[model samples]
Each structure stands twice: as structure tokens, then as C-alpha cells.
Target: MKITVLGVGGMGSRFALMLHQGGNDVTLVDGWQANIDAIRKDGIQANFNGKPVSAKMPIYSPAEIDQSGVKADLIVVFLKSNQLDAMFKRVQPIIHKDTYVLCLLNGIGHEDVLSKYVAKDHLLLGITMWTAGMTGPGHVELSGDGEVELENFEPAGEAFAKQVVSVFEGAGLNPKYSHDVKYSIWRKACVNGTLNCLCALLDCNIGEFGKTKQAPELLHTIIDEFAAVADKEGVNLDTEEVYNHVAATFTSDIAGHYPSMHQDLVQNHRLTEIEFIDGAVARKGEQYGIATPYCKLLTQMVHVKEQLVGAK
Candidate 1:
């Protein structure tokens, strides 16, 4: 399969490397010059299960997309929510009518942005629990076991979804087709709303945050807020179940890792996806006359932190 991985950052680099090594023709496109340059000079350096794996695949910046003359059978998007629109537009030339665009991006409102670029029939909405972090330019550290759930939002995309799934499973990506992926997306967002944001705000990894006594009380409140918002949107989120799912990330397996949000707003000194995650919940709650005080406050605090550090 000819695939184009848009936004070759931490998560992007991980999947790109796997798919390429799995014998698919995969090319990468990202906004970061250093990442592209590093991959071009050497190869993407990645560690999986405590073992180092290296592979050479063509990596390009957005400006070089069309000139690469590649028509992608699939476009796996791993972009941050805010950067989706412009980047998707730049990669449009490769998206033919039969091409499937699978978005495994974090947070919400991504399909709204993506729908503007591709037909609903060509759009595949997905959520992945896979955790990957960039070590440096063109380098990533990936560990732990994670799977992805994706679905076709339109009947026209069903066949495409199955085709994509076969390819993913062939690459050992472990994918399942979800008839209702919104629930999964919302559940993952709930995890991000808590672990991703709180860890970023405190400048700590999950282990450090979990060690604090206040973690449970804070988790309860945040999960309640997210549950309320999700309920309003018809996604039934069991607070206790959701809380447990999120708390599992604090174990020794992924405890030392800071989530992608922390890597974005802190390590990389860039803007975050809070607006599309917690902030999105807050907005939906507002529309439905539900109060999301926690999400609203967290969103405000993250924005303030972004301003303090001059994030864009």
C-alpha cells in the first residue's frame, strides 16, 4: 500500500516506521524542518520494547508534498488538532476519491476540520491508545502495548475501513472496527483531559503526579466534569470505569513518560490540543446548559501557561 503519514512527529514517526518496515510504501510529511532534515540525513531512530530499530523512509515537509508525485492509497494523520486544517489542505493533492484518510489524532472536532478536505465517504475516524514520544529530531521512544479502534462514519467508507484494517493488522497494529467510535474518542479525551493536561500543568510525568495524595480527588472532579459533558453529547461515560482506564497509565510501564501534550507545551515549547479536548468539552457543556467549571478552568490555565512561555 502507498501511504502518506501526515504530521511526522512523535506518534507519526512511530506509525510511519512500523508501516514502512511492514513493507508498505510510506512517506512522511511534517511541519518541523529539523525532523525532516534528520530523517533525510540518517534514518528515524526509535526504540520499541527497549530495543533500537532504525529505518530509512522519505520524509518531507508540507511544502514538498505535491512535488513528491505520490498518490497515496491511505493517508494516516497524526497531527495535532489545531494544525490539522492547513496541513490537510497542503496534502490534498494526494487524496484521490478512492483514497482513505484515517485520522488517529487526539482530542475532538478533528473530523469537522477533516471533513472540509475529504468527502465523508473517504473519512475514517479513529482513536488510538498507543503512546509514543519523540526523543529528539527524527528520533522517538515507543514502548508499551496499545491498540486502535476506528470506524467508517458513512456507509460509503465501510469497505475502505475494512481494507485499511487489514493493512493495519498486517503491520501488527491491532485494529478493531468500532460501529460507535465516538464513545472511544470521548473516553480517550477524558483520559487526556485528566492525565495529559494535569501532567503538563504540573510539569511531571504520570508517576510523579500519581504519587501525590491529591491525585484521586483531582481525578474524580475532572472525570466528573468530562462525564457530564460527554453525557450531554450522548456518549455514556462511566466515571469509575473511565477513571480506572486512565489511572492504569501511571504504572511502571508508562509511568516515566510524559504524554504528548506535555511534550508539546513544555518540552517542544508549542501550543497544545487542550482547546479541542478539555476546552471542547467545556464548550459543548455550555451549549447544553451544563456546567463544566473544571474543564473551563483547566483550559484557561493552559492558555495562560502557553502565553507565559510564548507558545504558538
Candidate 2:
């Protein structure tokens, strides 16, 4: 299989190296000059599965992807939610009629954006429990065990979904096909809405946040809001199940790891995907005549912090 991974930061690079070493042709696409130079010169210096390892493969920027005229059977998107529109536009040269597009991006409402770029049968919706973090240029620290749940966003697209599954399995990526992936996506979004934002605001990881007496209390407010909005959007999320899932992450192997939003705004001083997570829930609440004060306020606070530091 020939694959092009968009947004080759942490998750993208990790998957690219895995797939390439799995005997598939994989190309990494990123906007970072230092990361591109490092991989092209040395290799992808990744701590895959908690062991120090390295893998070499092609790395290119978006412009170079266009100039090189490369194409792919699969295009996996792992971009920051805010960068979806612009990043998709830049990677136009990779999409073809039969190309399958999968969005393993965090949060909700991303299918609307991806639908504009790919046809129904060629579209896939999925979420990863995997964790990866960028340590530096061409280097990532990937640890622990994670599984990917994927489903065809379009009906009758099962065959194509299986094809993508085979590729992931070949790379030792535990892949499962889900019939109710929307529920899964929303469940994951709820996890992010609770963990990512609060962790960012409190400057802590899952373990640190879990240690607080108010952690579950704070989670209830956000998850209640997310549950209401998700219900209005035709996905009924069980509050108890969702809460348990998010709470479980606190004791998981990656509990010490910083959530991505913290990695963006707090550590790197970069922009966050607040709008895509809690903010998206807030928007849906307004549309459906539901109040989402918790999400609204949290979203606003993240933005205010971003402005205070002039985070991009």
C-alpha cells in the first residue's frame, strides 16, 4: 500500500514509520523545516512502544509534495483540528478518484470538512487510543499500547475499510472495524473535552488531575454538557459509560503524559483545538436550544489564555 500521512508531527510520524517498516510505501508530510531536514538526513528517531528505535522513510513538506507529484492509495490525516482546511488544501495533489481518506483527528465535526475533499465511499472515520509526543526535530516519544477503531463513513464502503484495516494490521497497529463509530468518536471527544482543556488550564497531566477531589466533579460538568449536545446531534451518549472511560485514562499507562492541548498552548505556546472540542459542543447546544455554560466558559478561558501569551 502507498500511504501519505498528513500533519507528520507526532502521531503522523509514528504511524508513517510503522507502516513503512511494515512493507508499505509511506511518505511523511509536515510543515516543519527542522523536522523535515532531520528525517531526510538521519531518520525518524522515535521511541516506538517505549523502546528507542529509528526508521527511515521519505519526508516532505506540502509544497514539495505538490512539486514531486506523489499520489497515495490512502491519506491519513492527523492534523490539529484548526489546521484541517488549510492542510487539506495543500495536500491536494495526493488525492485521486480511488483514494481512501481516513481522519484519525481528535474531537468532532471533522467529517464535515473531510467530506468536502473526498467522496462518500472513499471516506473513513476513526479514532486512536494511541499516544505519541514530539520530543524534538525528527524525534518522537511513543509509548504504551493503543488500538484504532475505524469505520466507513459511507454505507457499502466496507470493502475499502477492510483494505485500510489490512494495512494497519500489517504494521502491528491493532485495528478494529466498528459499526457504531459515531458513538466512539463522541466518546473520545468527551474524553478530550474533559481531559485536554482542564489539563491545559490546570497545567497537569491525567495522573495529576486525577489526584484532585474535584476532578470527577469537573468532569461531570463538561461531560453533562457534551452528553446533551451529543444527544441533540443524534448520538445518545451514556453519561456513566463516558465518565468511566475518561476516568480510566487517569490510571492508564500514559497517565503521566500531557494532553495534546497542553502540548500546544502551555508547552509550545501554540494554538489549541478548543473550538473543535468543547466549543463545538457549545455551538451545538445553542443550535439545539440547550445551555452549555460549562463548555462555553471553558472554551472562552482557553482562548483568553491563548491571547495572553499571543499563542498562534
Task: Please state every model's RMSD to the true fold in angstroms.
Answer: 1.1, 1.1
TM per model?
0.97, 0.97
**Pairs of residues at least 3 apart in sequence or in different chains that clash in candidate 1:** none
lDDT score for candidate 2 against the true structure: 0.89
- Model 2 earns a TM-score of 0.97
lDDT of 2 by residue, 1-312 (tens): 989888878888778888888999888888878989999998899887767888888878878877877899999998899999988888888899989999999899998898888887789999999888888889898888889999998886899898888889999889999999999999999989999999999999989999899998999889999998888788999999889989998888989989889988898888999999999999989999999999999999999999987898
CA shift of 123, model 2, Å: 0.6
lDDT of each: 0.88, 0.89
The regions of model 2 sitting more than 4 angstroms off are none
Q: How many residue pairs clash in each candidate?
A: 0, 0
Q: What is the lDDT of residue 278 in candidate 1?
A: 92
Please give the lDDT score for candidate 1.
0.88
10 residues in a row with least lDDT, candidate 1: 245-254
